[model samples]
Each structure stands twice: as structure tokens, then as C-alpha cells.
Target: MYTLLSGLYKYMFQKDEYCILILGLDNAGKTTFLEQSKTRFHKNYKGMSLSKITTTVGLNIGTVDVGKARLMFWDLGGQEELQSLWDKYYAECHGVIYVIDSTDEERLSESKRAFEKMVTSEALDGVPILVLANKQDVETCLSIPDIKTAFSDCTSKIGRRDCLTQACSALTG
Candidate 1:
């Protein structure tokens, strides 16, 4: 059974569609990240204006094909009121990209709480998580290591799940 399941997983990953959720607190750069990703992955893609990107009231969906993998991304709104809608997409997401506004020290605690809540969900078990410490281009932005330390508990809660935390500038990408 284990071998069969492993084979099925490999086959699906190699030939089927995959979904990724881009989640974070409001103004944490989720939409910017999605736009950047689209610009980078899609050929001749005319990306959105970073300066004009506004808060996401609901969700922004994007798709890109890289090699044989057709990736569908759900960039969900991160407002406190919209967080309830996040879990609805979790069960179908193959991976998660959790963004954080590295320059907003004031909301670090709130972000941490939200991250902890997401990572603890049973639906996300064994899913790979990429925590992007965004807004690094800001002069006052926290360093990647500092951001990681701030969410140490959240990462620890992702037990046995593959997770990577990195600093990035969504605006510059």
C-alpha cells in the first residue's frame, strides 16, 4: 500500500495539475508576490503595476506552466475577516507560500498568530511550506534570520513538513 501510494503521488506530481496557496496577513505582499511570480514564469507576461497594487478584497488567481507542471495559484486575501475563507482552499493546496511584511514590525505578532493557526491545520499535514519574508527592499525591513526567529514557533509547529523561509522583495521582482 505504501509503495502504491508513493507511486501514485509521484505520477500525479509529474503529470497532473498542482495548486499553491499564497497566504499572509493584509498588506503582506501576497498579491505582489503572485504578480511577480506570473511575470517570471509566463512568457511575454505584462505584469501589474506594483505601485498601484491594492489590498485584495477576496482572492487573486493565477496560472503558469513550468516544464510539465501546470501550477495554479490562489492568492487569497489576508484580512482578519477573510481568514475564515482560507481553510476552504487548504485541502486542495499541494503547497503553501506564506508571505510576511518584513518591514511591519508592529504586526509581527498578528502574523505569527495567523501563521501558527494555518500551519496547525490538519489539512496542511505533510505539505511543503515556503515562508517568504517579503518587503526586504525596505530600508527598515527585518533581516531574514530575524524574521525566521520571530516565527520560530510557527515553523516548529509544521512538524515533519518540508518548509523553507527566505527573504524576498516582491515589489522588485
Candidate 2:
């Protein structure tokens, strides 16, 4: 199974349809960012399973083209209930986008815990983690450096540096 999956992955990577999973707490704007991506627009994507501020219920698969490659964007459910489901799919993912709400002060701790869980989880070892410092347009948003620090601290716990965390402004104009 691993061989077949690996071959398929190589084909996709060459053909450029590698899959990526996007994760963040509720209200992190993960969906909004996917909805507004240029590839989404070009694909004329008709979104499935849109949730404004609730647990994802399950995974939602979306497609976007990134120049040479087609990106399979997997938007994971961010609610606490859905966390258990994350480990099952983490191994299949090629990359990740870890989104965080910049303005939610009370939930930062929760976000940190969730991130820490991913950092320590066995399923995500050596995966490329892209941290999206979302909601940057808000008056009170976490800075890129702060996000990187949090990610770095979590990764340090594992005594490995496989988590490549990157911060991006998903909502900034």
C-alpha cells in the first residue's frame, strides 16, 4: 500500500497535484482563505460543506491550481471533536497550513495546545508545516514573529526540525 501510495504521490507531484491540509481553530479564517484563493477563482470552485464558525464536521476537499501544480486543499475540521480525526489523515498529507486567529486572546492557549499536539504527534513527523498568521487585518492580531516563536517552541519539544512553519496574512488586502 505504501508503495502504491508513494508512486501515486510521485505522479501527482510531477503532474503537480500534491495534497495539502489546512488546519486552524474555529474562526481562524481557514475557509475564507481557501475560498478567496486565485486558483479557487480560476477553477470556478463551487464550495462544499461551508461552515462559518463551527467544527468542520468532516473534511472538505477543494482544488486550486498553482501555476504548474494542482493543489488539493484539505480543510480539516478545527473543533475539538474533530481533532481525533486529524491523526488519521496527517500521514497522507504532503504539506500543511497551520492557521491561527490573530485576534482571539482567550483561545491562543487552546491553539497552542493543538499545535503542540501536532508537533508531538507521530503522524506528522517530517511534514512541512506552513503557519498562516491569519486575521492579520484585525486590530489585534498575533505577529508573524510571535507565531513563528510558538511553532518553534512546539517543534523544539520533539527534538526535531521537520515542521517548516511559515506565516502568511490570509485576510490582509
Candidate 3:
């Protein structure tokens, strides 16, 4: 009887875990987004002060419980060299959040290239992608339409998967 009751208790409390990857070019606000999410979703979680956040040299991990689901976020570093390591986590991720620094027009093409490569990987086939045009609060940031236009070519490579593009100021939201 005790064994059966313990099993029931475990089943009742276990959560469905989903692993999400937060990826983008350096300074694209991936970490900020993660911090904000944790603060919002997990009551009593005192996240780091956003102003003092620094470049993620490797990765940062955070978890939030929503309903019966637990979301695990892996915020990866976006440096050119670090990008090569992104694929190592692809197979395990349930979804990908690709952040683009809309205010940095000069690096837009480079960001697109990286994004194209990520979506084409067979490991990420059919994985849902959330494209965030970050830094929208900046005066000169690109609009969602502009970002969509710039990344139009990648649509074909994205395959038949759930994809969305939205403007977000990670720092402010």
C-alpha cells in the first residue's frame, strides 16, 4: 500500500519538462529575456539586476514552472566562435528562440546567415522557432516587417514548422 501511494504521489507532482534554447548574436538580449521570463514566471525569484548583466561567455540556464509544465531555458553565448557549439544542444531542445539585435543594422546580414544555418540543421528539423526582433525600445531599431523582409530567404529553409516574428524590447519587457 505504501509503495502504491508513493507512486501516486510522484505521478501527481511530476511536471512535463520542455527544453528551450535561447540563441542569438552577442548583445541581442537573450540573457535579459531569460532573466525577465524567470522573474515573471517564478514568484519570489529575484533575478539579477538587468543593468549589470554582462555578455554570456558560455551559457546560462534557468527554469520556470508554468501549470503542469516545466520550461528549461538554455541561453547560449553568441560570439562567432561560440556559435559552433550551438548544434551540440540542438537535438535536445524542444524549441528555439532566435534573438536579433534590431538596432544593429550593420550586423543584420551576419545574424541572418547564422539563423539560416541553424534552421537548416537536420537536428532542428520541424522544431518551432520564435524570432524576436529585440531592442525595439531603441529609437532606431528595425521593425518586425523589416526583420521579416531581411530574413525572407530563410523561410524556405525553415520548413513546415511553427514560426513567429515579433518585436520585443527584452530590456524593457
Candidate 4:
């Protein structure tokens, strides 16, 4: 009875916590998305200047509370060298948000390769994936359907894991 009451109390009073990883190729707006989420979900958050935000060499951590849940975001560096370190965090994350530069046609293939590698990792086998086709504010950006089509094979490779692809402008949001 004591254990049951304690569990109930914890569930009712403590916020559920989840860890999410933000990943993408270089200049794909991962950091911008983190900052935008913080600014939108956190009260009194004085976010940094988007223009001043440079390439992330390491990880930038952010936290936000929504409803009864607390979400912790790990925005990792997207450089080719940094990608080797992503698997280290795969076991600890509950979900992944992969950002893509919709306007960069040249890097789409490279991004697809990296994304396929990540999604197929045994450590991340069942994790949910949220692919953000960023830079939608640009006139030349690819549409959501086009982006989906480009990554369809990679998405299929994820097996039974939940995956969603959405269009977004991290800079504007």
C-alpha cells in the first residue's frame, strides 16, 4: 500500500521527463530550431540573436516544460566529424528531430546518407523520428511532399518506428 501510494504521488505531482536529440547536417538549422523552441515554450527566455548563432561545435542543451511533461533537448553538432559521436547519445534519447536544409539541393544526398545511418542504428531502433524540412520560408525550398519523397527510402528503413516529416522555418519561428 505504501509503495502504491508513493508511485501515485510521484505520477500525480512530478512532471514526466523525456530526452530528445536534435540532429542534422551542418547549417541545417538544428541550433536555430532549439532556440526557437526555447523561446516559444519557455517564459522570460531571452534568446540569442539568430544572426549571431554560428555552427555548433559541441552540444547545446535546452529544457522546456509543457503541460505535465518536461522535455530536455540535446542539440548536437552536425559536422561530419561530430556525427561519429551521435551514437553515444542514441541509447539515452526518447526521440529524434532530424532537421534538413530544404533549400540546399547539393547536400540532400549527403544528408540522406547520414540520416539513413542514424535511423538504422540498433541503439535507436524503436525511437520515434521527426524530420523537419527547414527553410520553408525560402522561395526555392522543397515542399514537404518532395522532401518526403527524397527521404522515403530512409524512412522505410526505420521499420516500425513512428516517423513524421514536417515543413518548418526555424529562423522565422
Best by lDDT: 3
Model 1's alpha-carbon lDDT is 0.92
lDDT string for model 1 (75-146, tens) is 999999999999999999999999999999999999999999999999999999999999999999999889
TM-score of 4: 0.92
Task: Report the CA-based lDDT of candidate 3 relative to the real structure.
Answer: 0.95
Clashing pairs in 3: none
**Residue clash pairs of candidate 1:** none
Show where candidate 3 strays beyond 4 Å. none
| Top of the candidates by TM-score | 3
lDDT of 2: 0.74
RMSD to true structure for each model, in Å: 5.8, 5.7, 0.8, 2.5
Model-by-model lDDT, in order? Answer: 0.92, 0.74, 0.95, 0.94
TM per candidate comes to: 0.89, 0.76, 0.97, 0.92
Model 4 per-residue lDDT tens digits across residues 54-91: 99998999999999999999999999999999999999
Rank candidates by TM-score, best first.
3, 4, 1, 2
lDDT per residue as tens, model 2, 1-173: 99999999887677566888888787787877776664345755544434543455687777877667778889888999888778888878888888888778678889989888876777777777777778777767777777766556675765544555445555442
Per residue, candidate 3 scores C-alpha lDDT tens digits across 42-113 of: 789999999999999999999999999999999999999999999999999999999999999999999999
Q: For model 2, what is the alpha-carbon lDDT of residue 10?
A: 83
Overlapping backbone residue pairs in candidate 2 total: 1
The candidate 2 region of ten consecutive residues with least summed lDDT is 46-55
